[model samples]
Target chain A: MKLLAITSCPNGIAHTYMAAESLRKAAEALGVEIKVETQGSIGVENEFTPEEIEQADGIIIAADKAVDKSRFTGKKLIVTGVQDGIHKAPELIKRFESGDVDAYQGDGKSINEVKQERKQKQNPFYRHLMNGVSYMIPFVAVGGLLIALSLAIGGHPTDSGLQIPKDSVWKQIMDVGSAGFTFMVPILAGFIAMSIADRPGLAPGMIGGYIAANGSFYGSEAGAGFLGGILAGFVAGYIAKWIKTWKVPSVIQPIMPILVIPLLASILVASLFIFIVGAPIASLMDWLTAFLNGMQGASSIILALILGAMISFDMGGPVNKVAFLFGASMIGQGNVHIMGAIAAAIAVPPLGMGLATLLNKRKYEKAEQEAGKAALAMGLVGITEGAIPFAAKDPLRVIPSIMAGSMVASTIAMLGNVGNNVPHGGPIVAVLGAISHPLMYFIGIIAGVIVTALVVNLFKKNVA
Target chain B: MKLTELMDKSLVDIDLNGSSKNEVLDEMIEKLDQSGALKSKRKFRKTIEKREKEGSTGIGFKVAIPHGKSKAVTSPKVAFGLSRTGVDWNSVDGEPARLVFMIAVPEESAGNEHLKILQMLSIKLMDEQFRTELLQVQTVDEAYELLDQIG
Candidate 1:
C-alpha cells in the first residue's frame, strides 16, 4: 500500500523532522511505500507531487500547527498532532491496512467556528430585527437627548408637560431633533431590508415605512408606529429578494439590482400599506395607546411587573427590546410614566451584578471582580449588557436575582408617578434632568440594586 | 556557515549529570551561558520553560530538543548534551530522554545560512544510524567532529 504523510510544528524546529523520520521508518518496516513531507524552519521539504498524492491509498497529517489539507481532497486521510506522529506512527499506518479509513473532502473548521456558523445560519429573523434596532438607536439617542436639552433650557412646565417657545433657538434645536425623529422609522425599515436583501431593498423599505407612519394615506388620525415599520421592512425585503430569483434576459440583467428590483418593491410595498395594511395597523396603534392611557392602579402595576421581568429576562435581547420599544413609543404619545418605569428597570441588572461582587468578593473570581468595576460604570450610564458576563457564567442564579430586583424598581417608579421624557434609562437620565421625581427614581434604583446583590449572594457558594 | 560555527567543542557535553528535566535544562543553559551566547540566562530560561509548558520538546525515541527564541540571547547558538542515565522529559513515547539539544536564537537573528544548518541537524538526528553513532561518542571532540560533517 502507498501512503503519504505530512508533519509540522509551530516553531518548525525539531518535532516536524522527528515525526517525519518516525513515520518513514515505521512504513518501511511494515513493507509499505511512503513519502514523507516535513515543514520545518527552512520550509517545506520532500513535498509530494500531484501524481504521488494520486497514487497514494491514504494520507496522514500530523501537525502541531495548521497545514493546508486542500490538495489531499478525495484521499483517505488521518489527521493528528505531531506528538502522535512520533509515538503512534505504527498504529496510524496500520489504519489504512485495516480498511476503515474514509476519503477526506478537504473542508475542516475548528469546533468553535462551526458552532458560530450554525448560530448565524439558523436565526436570520432575529439577526434582521437586531440589525434594524442597532441602526435605529443612534437616531433615538440624539433626538431624545436634544429634545430633553431644549425642554431643560428653554421651557416651563404647563398642565400638558414641558414645551419650548416656537420662535427660540432651543425650538430650532428641538426641531432639528424632531427632524431626526422623522427619519427613525424609515431608517429602521430601510436597514432591516438592506440586511435581508442587500442594497437594492433600501429605497423600497424606507418608502414603505414612511407610508406606514403617515395616517393620511389610509384616512386615520394616529399613525402606525414601530410595529408598522417592522412589517413594512419584512414585506419590502422579501419582495425585493424574491424578485432577484426570477430569471431575466441578458439585456435586462444589468439594471436588475440598481433599478428594477427597488422600483417594483417600492410600488408593491407602498400600495399594500396604503390600500390594505395601513388602516388596521394605525387602528392597532390607537387601541394600544388608549389601553395604556386608561390603565388604573392595578393594571399599571401589572404592566410594570411585566416590563420589569422582560427587561431583565434576556438583558437586551428580543424580550427586552419589546418592553423598551413599548415604553419609547409612549413618549411620542404624551405618556412618559411608562418609560420612567422602564428606565428604572433597565439600570437594575448591571447595577445589581456590580453590587453583588462588592457585597461578597469570594463568590466571584478575580476577573469577575474587575468586570464588576466596569459593570458599575456601565450601570450608571444604563447599559443592560454590562451584566452579561455574570449572567453568562451563572444564568439561573444571576438572571432570577436581577429580575426580582428590576420588578421592585419598576413597581416603585410606577407608584411614585415618576416621569421620563427621553427614550433612555438609568441614573444618567435623572442627572440630565429628563426625569420627573428624580429622588424616587434614585430610591428605586438603589433598592433594586441592593435586592439583587443580596439575593444573588444568598444563592452562590463561596469560591474555593 | 554551518551548525559547527554555532556549536563548538565547549558546547558539547558527552557526560551529563542531570537526572531530571529541570536539572538537564540548567546544565544545558550553563554550557550555552559559558559559551557567551546568552546575555541573561534567567530570561532565556523563562522563555524555554514557557515553550516547554505549551508542549514538551521531547520528540520521542529517547531524544529531546529544548529551544528558545528570545531577546536575552546574544547570538544564535546550539548546545548538545548526552545523559547516560536518561531524564524524564514527558516524552510521547513514555521513555526518558538521553540525547538533548538546546538551541538558542536571538529574537531578531534572521540569518538563513545557520538556520538551514540547524534544520539539517534536526533532520539528521532523526536517523537511527546517526543517533547510534552519537551515543558511541566518548568525548566532546568526537561529537563535535561528527556534527561538523552536516554543514
Candidate 2:
C-alpha cells in the first residue's frame, strides 16, 4: 500500500515543519508505507512519482494555505488544515486503515489555484478591506508600543492628560510612534486596494483612506476612522478593477494602466468619498464618539459589555476588528478613555487562556500548555490573536469566558478614568506610558484575566 | 539486529519498472505478496495507506521507508529494493528515491518492531561507506549480505 501527504503553513515557517515532523514520527510508529512532500517557504520537497500514486491508498493534505491537488486524482484524499494534521495524525491514520477515505479527484488545481479561484470569486470590496487590515496590524503594533513605552517612562500627569516634556527623548519616541500611527489608515487602505486592483488601486485607496481618516477632506473633525479605510479600500479596488476591465483600443491599452486607469479611479474614488461615503460615515462616527463620551455611570457598563463582546466574539475576526476600529477612532478624537477600555479588553483573552493552561495543565495537551506561555506573553504585548487557536478549537466556552473577562476589565477601566493615547490594548501598553492611570489599568487587566482563566477552567473539560 | 532476521529474502526486488509513487507502491506490495510476506493484498494496502495518511515515511537522502502495521503482515520484516533510475517516493528533500525500504510489522508488536527497524536503518544509513557499498551491489544477495554485515 502506498500513500501521499503534503504539509504546509501560512508563513511556510515553523508550524509547517513542526506538523510535518509530528506526522512523520506518527506514521513511522504506525508502521505504514507513506510518502510525504513538504511545501515549505523554500519550495516543494520530495515530489511523488506517477508509479507511487497508482499503488497508493490515500492522500493527506495538511496545510494552512492551499496546496495543489491535481496529482491525487482517484486516490483517497483527506483534506484538513495544518493543526488538524498535528493533533489528529493518529486518528486520521486509523480512519484510513478503516478504508473510509474517498478518492480525491484532481481538478488540475493546487491549493494556490483554489485560492486564486476563491479570490476571483470574492467581493472586491471585502478583498481590499482584508488586504488593508493585514498590512495595518504591524504598524499599529509598532506605533502603539513605542508610544506606550514613551508615556510610561517620560509622562507626567497634566490637566490635558499624560504629558511628556517636549525636550525629552521619551517625547521624541512618542512623536515617532505617532508618525507611524498616522500612516496606519492610509497604509491599510492602500494595501487593500493594491491586493484588489494591483498597483493602480494603491494611490486611490490611500487617498480614500486619508480622506476617511481625516474628516477635513469631507468637512468633519472626526474622520470616518478605520471604517472609512474599509470603504476606501473597497471603492478603490472595484473602481480600479472596473477601469481595467473596460474595452479600449488595442493601441491605447499600453497607456491605460499607467495614465487612464489610475487617474480615472483615483478621481472617481476620491469624489465618491468626498460626496457620498464620507459625510454619513463621519456623522455616524460622531454619534458613536458622542455616545462613548457621554457614557459616565451605568452607560459605561453597557459600553464595556458591548466592547468586550466585540473583542472576544471572533478572537480577532470581524467583530474584533470593529471594536478595535472604534477604539482607534476614539484615539484620533483625543478621547483616550475608549482606547483604555479597549486595552483592558484586549489583554483578557490571552491572559485568561494562559492562566487556564497554567492552572489546569490536565485540561490541555502538551502543545497547548506550551502555546499558553506564548499567548500570555503576547497578551502582555497587546496581541489579541494569541487566543485565536484556543478559540477556534472551542469557541462556545472560550468566547464567553474571554468576553466576560474583557467586559469586567473594560468597565473597570472606564470607571477608573483610565485613558490611553494610543489605539492598542494590553497591560504592556498601559505600563509603557500610552495609558493614564497605569496602575489601575494594570489592576483591571489582571482582574479580568483572572476571571477569564477561572471561567474557562470551570467550563473546559480535561481532554488530555 | 541480523539483517536476515529483519529482511525476508524473497521480498527483495532487483528491478523496478514503475516510476511513479503509486506504481512503485503497487510493485513493492506485489513483490511482498509474491514472497508470501503479505497475507491479504487489500488489507496490506489499507494498512500502508493508513500509515501514509498519517504521514510520509520519506526521510531525506535518496532513501524512502514505507512501512505499516497490519494483520496482513506475517512477520516484522524489511524489504530492500533498488531503483537506479530514481523512483519518486516523495522524499523529504524532494529527491527521487533510489533505495526503497518497505517495512511490515504485526499490529500487536507494531511500536517496538517499528522503532527497532527504524533505529537500525537510520544508524546504517548514516554511514557513507555502508550506503556506497549497498548502492554498488547489483544483486539481491549482495545487498542482503551488506545489510546482514551492517546489522
Candidate 3:
C-alpha cells in the first residue's frame, strides 16, 4: 500500500517534474500512499526519509540516465524510462502489486554497468543522439564566444575581411579559439559512439571524425565537416558494436573492448569515409555553397526562410545543428551572409517567448512569467535552449510562434545584406563587432520579436 | 497557531452522513455554524461554493480542503468531517474525497492568516502516517490529539 518513486531525465528539467507529478496523481487515484522524489535541474526535492523508505512496500526508479539503486537493496524495485512514469504509472504500480519486480541486489558494479542493463529498454538512436548533443553544446558555446571576443578586441576591418594583427596576444587568443573549433567535430563523434557502444567506441569515433574533417585524407579541397563527422560516428559506433558481438576466446574477452573492437572499428570507419562517403558529400557541399552564392533577392529570401524554420524547429536539435554547421563552414570559406541571417534567427524563439509574456501577462502563469525573465537573459546571450522550457510545456503554440518569428528576422537580415564575420549569433555578438550593418540586424530582431509576441498572445488564453 | 486551537470538538464530525460533495460541504458548515464560528450559514455556504468554482479544493489522498474568506466568519476556524463512503469533489486525481476540512476566515484577517493556516495544514497532510492515524481516530478527542501535532 505504501510506495516510493524517483524520477529524473538527462536535462533534469521538464520531463523530470512532469513524471513526478504524473506518478503522484496516479497514486492518489489508486488510493495508495506514495511519496515521490524528483531529481531535476534545480536539484533534489521532496526527498524520502529513511523511515519512509523502511516502511515502503516498493520503489520505482524512472529515469533516462543512471540512478544508484544500492540503497534499495532487498526492496521490490522497478527500473524503467521516465516516459513510463508519466504515461504508465498505474500499470507500473499494478506490476509492483502483482509482485513482478525483482528485489534490488547491491552488486558492486560501476554506474555504467547499471546503465547498460537498462539500455535495452530505450531507443538507442535517440539516447545516443541526445548524449552526443549534450556533450557537443559546451564546445560550440565556448569556441564561438572566444572567437567573437578575439575579433572584437584585436581585429581591424578591411576590404577582404576582419583581420587580426600577426604576433599579437589577440592573434594567440584567436588561435586558441580555433583550436576549440578543431576539436568540436571529433568530440561530438566520439561521444555519440561512446553512447552507442560504451568506452570501446571512443578511440575509433574520434579517429574517424578527424579523418572526415581533414581534406588530405580524401580527394576534396573542403573537408566534409560536421555532416561527415555524424556519418563517421554512426559508422564507428555500429562497427564497434558488431565487433563486440563476436565470440572471441575467453582469454581475449577482457581485452577485446580496449583493443580488438577499437582497432577494427577505426579501420572500417576510416575506409568508408575516405573511399565512399567523403568525396560525394564534399561535392554536394560545394554544389550547395555555389547554389547559395548564386541566389538572388527572392531565392535568397526562400533560403533564409528554410534556415529560420530549421533553427527554431527543435531549438537545439539535429535540424538546428545542420543549419549551424552550414553557416560555420561558410565562415571558413569567407562567406558571412548565410551566418548573418542565421544569427538573427537564433535569438527569435527565446526573445519572442519572453516578449509574449511581457506583452500579455494574463496569458501566462506565475512560473511562466519568471521563466520569461530567464529566457530574455538567455536570448541576449544567444542560447536558444532557453526557449526549450516553453516549447516543452506547449509545443504546438510555442513552436509555430517561434518559427514564424525566426523566419521574419532571417528574411529581413538577408534582404538588408547583413553579414556576421563570426560563427555565433545574437545581439551580443553584433555588439562585439562580429556583425556588419548592426542597425539593420537590430531592426530585424525587434520586428521578429514583436510579431511573435502579438501572434502568440492572440492565440493563448488567459491562465488561472 | 496549532490546529487544535482553531478546531472545535463540536465541529469535528467523526461519521458524516453525505453521499455527494455538496451534501458533505453543507454537513461540515452546519458544524461550524453550531460552534458560532460562522455568522450566516447561507452566506458562508455561498462563499465556499464560489471558491470551489475557481478550482476544486480536493488536495487528493481522499481529502477535500474547502476554504473561504468572508464577512460571514467572525474569526478564523477549521471544521473537520469524515465521510467513510467518500464524495466526489472532482479532484485532480479523479478520486472521491473522504476526509474534509472546511476553513473559514474573517475578511479583515484573511490575507495572512488564511494562507498561513492552509500552508500549515497542507504540509502536515502530506505526511501519510499522520493521515493514516487521523483516519483511524474513533473519538473527537482522539482526532483532535492527532491534528494537534501539526503547528
Candidate 4:
C-alpha cells in the first residue's frame, strides 16, 4: 500500500522532522511505501507530486498548524496533531488499515463554512442597530422626560389639547425637549451607519435620516420617524461601502475616502428619499387617512384594532400619523371615543417594552437593559416612540408583539366608552382629567402593557 | 561541509547531571554556548522555550529533540546528552526521556545542505539499535564518535 502524510508544527523546527521520521519508520515496518512531506523551518521539503497524490490509498495530516487540506478533497484523510504523528504513528496507520477514516471535503464553501458565515453575518445587523440605539436613548429620555414634566407641572388642558402657555419657562423646556426629539432620528441613523461603514457613512446616513423624519421633503404632512431612520441608515451605509470598493484612479484614490465617497453616497440616498420612496409613502398616508375616515362608520371594534395596529406598527411613522390625525379630527366633531381608544393604544408600545426588560433581563444586552428602564418612564407619560429602539433591532419579533398589545388596549378602551378630548394619549392624559372613565383607561393601558411585555419576551431570543 | 563539522568533543555529555527537563536544557545550552555555536545564549534559549511551549519536544521512546532557529545562532550545531537516570520530559509516551538532542540553527541560514544533514540526524535517532547503542556510550568522546557517523 502506498500512502501520504504531511507533518507540521508551529515552530517547524524539530517536532516536524521528528514526526516525519517516526511516520516513515512506522510505514517501513508496516511494509507500505509512504511519502512524508516535511514542512519545517527550511520550508516545504519532499512535497508530493500530483501523480503520487492520485496514486495514494489514503492520506494522513499530522499537523498542529493549519494544513490546507483543499488539495486532498476526495481522499481518505486522517487529521491529527504533530504529537500524535510522533507517538501514535502506528495507531494512526492502523486506523487506515482497518478502513476507519473518511474522505475529506475542505473547500471553504462547504456546509460548515456556510453555517459559520450565517452566524457571523446575522448578528451584525442588530449590532449596528444597537450602536444607533445606544446613541438615541439619551435623546429620547431627555425629550420624553422634559415634555412629560413640562406638561405635568406647567400645562393646562384646552379645546386645542395639552399646551404649555407660549411665554412660560415650561414652554422653553418643552421646546428644548422638542429639539432633542428632532435630533433623535438623525443621530440614530448616523451612528448606525458609522457602525456599518465607519466614519464615511455618518453624514449620508444622518442626511437621509433627516429627510425621512421630515414629511415636507416629500409633500406629506407627517414625517417618517424611527423606522425610516433605520432604513436610511442601512441604505446610506451600504452605498458608502459599495462606493469604497470602486476601482478609481490613483490620483482620485487619495480624495476618494474623505471627499468623494461621502458626498456621492449622501446625495444618492437623499435623492432616493425625496424622489422615489417618499412619494409612494405620502400617497399611502393619504389613502390611509381616507380609509380611517371611512372606518369611522364601521364597527368600533374593527376601528379600534386598525387604529391600534397603525399606531404600534411604525410607532411614529406616516401610518401612525394618519391614525393620530384621524383621532384628533374626530374630537372636534364631538366623537371623542375614537381618540380615547387611540390614546390607550399609543402608550402600550413603550410600557410593554419596559415591562419586557423587567420580565426577562437575559434577552437584552446591557445598553438595552438601561434603555428599557428609560422606556418605562416614557411609557408612563405615553411616548410610543420609546419602543422604537427595541423594534428597530428585532422588528420581526417586536413589531407584531407591540401591535397585538395595542389592538387589545384600544379595543378595551372603546368597549369602556373612554373619551379623551385631548389630542395626546397615555396615562398622563387620563391623570390630567382629559379622559372620561379614567379607571377604565388605566385598565386598558395596563392590559396592553402586559400583553406587549409577555408576547415580546416570548418571541425574543436571549442576548448573544 | 559535513555533519561532523557541526559537532565536537565539547558538545557531547555521556552522563548528564541534570535530573529534570529544564535543568538538562540549561546544561546542554551551556555546552552549545561554550562550543561557540551561539551569538546570544538568551535569544537562542527564548526560541527553544517558545518551540517547547508549542508542544514538548520530548517525543516517545525515551527521546527528546529540543531545537531552535534564530538570529542568535552563529552556526548550525547539535548538543547531545544522555541521562543515566531519565529526566521527566512530559513525553507523548509518558516515559521519562533519557536521550536529548538540542539543535541550533541560524535564522538566515546560508547552508541548506547543513539543514538536510540535521534532518538525517533526526531520522537516524529513531532507529532502535542506534538509540540502544547511544545509551551504552561510556564517555563524551565515545558519544561524539557515535554521533559523528550520523550524517
lDDT of each: 0.80, 0.72, 0.75, 0.86
After superposing all C-alphas onto the true structure, candidate 3 shows an RMSD in angstroms of 24.2
What is the TM-score of each candidate's chain B when compared with the real chain B?
A: 0.96, 0.86, 0.92, 0.95
lDDT of 2 by residue, B22-137 (tens): 78888888877777677897899888887666656554467676777677877556778888788766655677887787777654331133344344565466455777787788
Which residue pairs in candidate 4 collide? none
Show where candidate 1 strays beyond 4 Å: A1-110, A130-134, A219-223, A249-251, A289-410, A414-438, A445-464, B1-151
- Report the TM-score for the A-chain of model 1: 0.51
Full candidate order by TM-score, most accurate first: 4, 3, 2, 1
lDDT of 4 by residue, A10-101 (tens): 76766788789899989989988889999976678897766676788999999999897766767899999988888788999988899999
Cα lDDT for residue A67, model 2?
A: 88
lDDT of 3 by residue, A1-464 (tens): 99999998654534565567668878988888889887754457787655676688999999877887765767789999876786688998888778898878767754344444444324566456556655655555455456656766776654334568898798988788678667767876788788887888999998997887776787765566565666677789988978876755444755787888899899999999888976775576566556554553447789898888877876654457567777777777887888889989998888898898898898886767766776676677566755655664455677888899999998899889999977666787787677999988988888888878887887787653
Model 4 spans > 4 angstroms off:
A1-122, B1-151
Give each candidate's fraction of reference contacts reproduced: 0.48, 0.00, 0.00, 0.33
Per-model TM against the reference: 0.41, 0.43, 0.44, 0.59
On TM-score, the stronger of 3 and 4 is 4
What are the clash counts of all predictions, listed in order?
Answer: 0, 32, 0, 0
Stretches of model 2 off by over 4 angstroms after superposition: A1-130, A289-300, A303-405, A412-443, A447-464, B1-151
Model 1, B117: alpha-carbon shift in Å? 57
lDDT preference between candidates 1 and 2, better one: 1
Evaluated at residue B48, the lDDT of candidate 2 is 80
**Deviation in angstroms for A149 in model 2?**
2.7
Query: Top model by TM-score, which number?
Result: 4
